[model samples]
Target: MDSGGTPEQVLMGGSMLIGTVGAYLVLGAYLVQLQHYCLAGAEGKRKNRLTLYILVGVVTVCETLRVCFITFAAWRVLVLGIGQPVLRQSPAKTAPSLHILGSFIALFIQGFFAWRIWTHKFNKILGAIAVLIGLLTTTQLIVGVLTGVQLGRIGAIAEQAAVTAGRNGVFNQFINNNQNPGGLTPFAISVGILTSTVFVCDVLITIGMFSIFHVYRKRSMAPRAKSALRVLSINTLENGLITSLCAALTLILYYARVHPWIHMAS
Candidate 1:
């Protein structure tokens, strides 16, 4: 190899470097947000204040662990295993587990939103929708954790045996391993659900926010109040829009018969 190394090495190395930097940047931003939240404290005498605090704490722990995992992966790929071809073929344990951790993070955050929606006043239809969306997010979280356990199993249970016996399994309905590369294993199906579930949940949250705020906007007489509602509605969508779009794109790519590894970009 030349002094620059092969093309694949350069690409992989550059990706690892950029990912590590981005992960730290995100961690820093999250810290700032957490600090701000603590300073602000509880907003009102809301009944779910305790639940909200617990959710925030869980999310903070998951975010920290996620960054630690990424740092460890960067260390493995760029420092410990630098220039080794095995890096190309062997997956890092931290890498796969990151998705599971991410699912936890998403689950907690959405749970917060769901709690908000439930606490806020809403019509029956919107309330029902929010409840259903919340249930879906919970189900997805369960599936994600189960899939992680399935992958990390340490017994004599063969993959084929477990999978074959899993026709009625909750997530197995999505896994159709009839063929080779195209066939969706439990892991692939779980990932696909994760992406789609994220997109669906975000969209529903945004819509619910809009619906809740629209009622207030319609009843308000003051122009300033209406304007504030307008801004808040836009902000609500903005908060979750990017996340939804990214999840949607990942889902598209995963189902498009493209390289399945593309989801790791999300």
Candidate 2:
């Protein structure tokens, strides 16, 4: 791949193309979902009106920004770098990074679930565990943002990062770690922590939901309410499992290094 994120790296063009198309596809689906939600008239006066608006606003903005950055990156590589000279350059070149934005949105959504876990009636032990899960999500956000900042210091011309070359350069130290625990760089350490938190947070949240179900099951609720809880528990399991699996797969593919494009596609 082009270390500078220039178009000279035709070898990884397929990866960038695939990623760009995937971004647009996902964006379309997201927008459609948002439209449906809006049409549902949930905006009609409600107790949590402000909270709902904020949730929608934050996700829309973050998702839009992610797609824009990725699109710009693809265009830069495929169009601008087409006939450009491939002079040897510093290994630590800068470019727009997407993971930080992803981290922010995931943290926001998962935080909502964490808040649900906290607010719902439960034992003190479970309440304490919910708080712990919330803290872990916050920690993930902080680490993700810090990693983006660190990467920006060493990568790109137009978007985010800038080049800083050397054996000890930020980029080299980052990519060199290879996920080794003993010699991990700050970036790798943060990534490892970030992915771990994602998996653990989702799992804990799902378990909390099940606990909530168990608590509600013992109550004398209406049949519809009980039915809703059952469906919710199933939904939670599916969502949590898919999220955790993706994070694990991405981490694995990243460390495998079989093909640079493979990890990017993940």
Best by lDDT: 1
Clashes of 2: 10
lDDT of 2 at 123: 88
Q: List, residue by residue over 17-60, the lDDT tens digit for candidate 2.
A: 76678678768867876887687556455668678778989989
Model 1 pairs whose backbones collide = none
The superposed Cα distance between candidate 2 and the true structure at residue 238, in angstroms, equals: 1.5
How close to the true structure is residue 110 of candidate 2, measured as C-alpha lDDT?
Answer: 79
Candidate 1 off by > 4 Å: 1-50, 150-186, 221-228, 255-259, 262-266
Candidate 2 residue 86 Cα shift, in angstroms, is: 4.9
Instruction: Provide the lDDT at 184 for model 1.
Output: 28
Measured with C-alpha atoms, the lDDT of residue 10 in candidate 1 is 50
Error of 1 at 200 (Å): 0.6
Q: Give the per-residue lDDT of model 1 (tens digit) for 73-176.
A: 66665666555644433345656566678778877878777766777746776777678778878877787776555533411123223345432222212222
Question: What TM-score would every model get versus the actual structure?
Answer: 0.70, 0.73
Model 1 scores worst on lDDT over the 10 consecutive residues at 168-177
